[model samples]
Target: MSRRTLVAGIGNVFLGDDGFGVETVRRLSAPGAAAARLPDGVETADIGVRGVHLAYQLLDGYDTLVLVDATARGGAPGTLYLIEAGADGPVAPQTPVLDGHQMSPDAVLALLDTLCAGTGAAPPRRIWVVGCEPGSLDEGIGLSPPVAAAVDEAVRMVLDLVHHQDEETPQDEPGVAAN
Candidate 1:
């Protein structure tokens, strides 16, 4: 398979559940890292609180991209959402914070779109986001109970998507998927 899958966790570790993304990455990076079971081609990285930095990461050769973050939209805490990258969607503005570190996921997508347009190349074939609802984004450094519990589930969902994608695409030979 191709090493063209990038899973990024985005969040601020200083805030409570807002740190969900970073924490999830940590959990998956531990010795028994649960996310390690994901399909062999995909690579995961923690992009904690980096705004435009995500765009740079996207510059790497990746056919698919998945971003995990904590979203607050008045939903029940710990709710998980599978969001596609686009303009017309239910995901709200990325204005949750006022600091310079704040950057919209859409903006990153736009940057990729512009780059692809300029170069006459296709953008990431797949871009998905797993958003976890946060009960509190107050000044703190950990995830609440519910959000923490959903970490494993989120990892599983992403891996499942990766596997399904692999099965859908025809490989050159058996056990050989795009890399």
Candidate 2:
């Protein structure tokens, strides 16, 4: 099977702003939603702290992967970061700005890699992470105003990238495929 696209949101619902990713998915999955207009073959999921279960969704085969999460690295609130996985940097697990989830994003990715290796499957060709800096990650329940606003921007960024890729990729010619 060719690679499909997967958008996995990871976070903690109990923690304020930590639920940004899951909340985004929930918003996307609404009835008669605009998210339905997303490209065909693109699937989205809310995998809050359940990174181990990611293998099942990811196993199907996906070329592009987008992960949305709330992060804090001393940046301004609602800061958006588009980071490529396995880029030139140390893949260290950072301490959570707010203690709610059991595993960090990098740890989840590592677990996914281990699962893929054990099953002899290839990982996605591209992995983009969209991070929103949080104003609060406390033991509260809702997203801060700034972080909430960032979700719209994050969705737009992901959608634009997907459409761009769809346009750039060539279709099959006769019996030859670009892949």
Clashes of each: 3, 0
RMSD of 1: 7.1
**Which stretch of 10 consecutive residues in model 1 shows the poorest summed lDDT?**
170-179
The residue pairs in collision within model 2 are none
Best by lDDT: 2
lDDT values for all models: 0.69, 0.71
> Which residue pairs collide in model 1, if any?
1-179, 2-178, 2-179
lDDT of 1 by residue, 1-179 (tens): 45578888888889888888777666665567575676676777888867667766677668888788887656778877766565364334445422337766765666666666776666677777777889888998878898888887766666666666545432232211112
Model 1 misplaced regions, further than 4 Å: 1-3, 87-100, 118-121, 166-179
Give the per-residue lDDT of model 2 (tens digit) for 58-152: 77678888787886666778877666677665355564323334667776666657667889877777776767788998998899998998777
TM-score per prediction, in order, is 0.78, 0.81
Per-residue lDDT value at 97 in model 1: 29
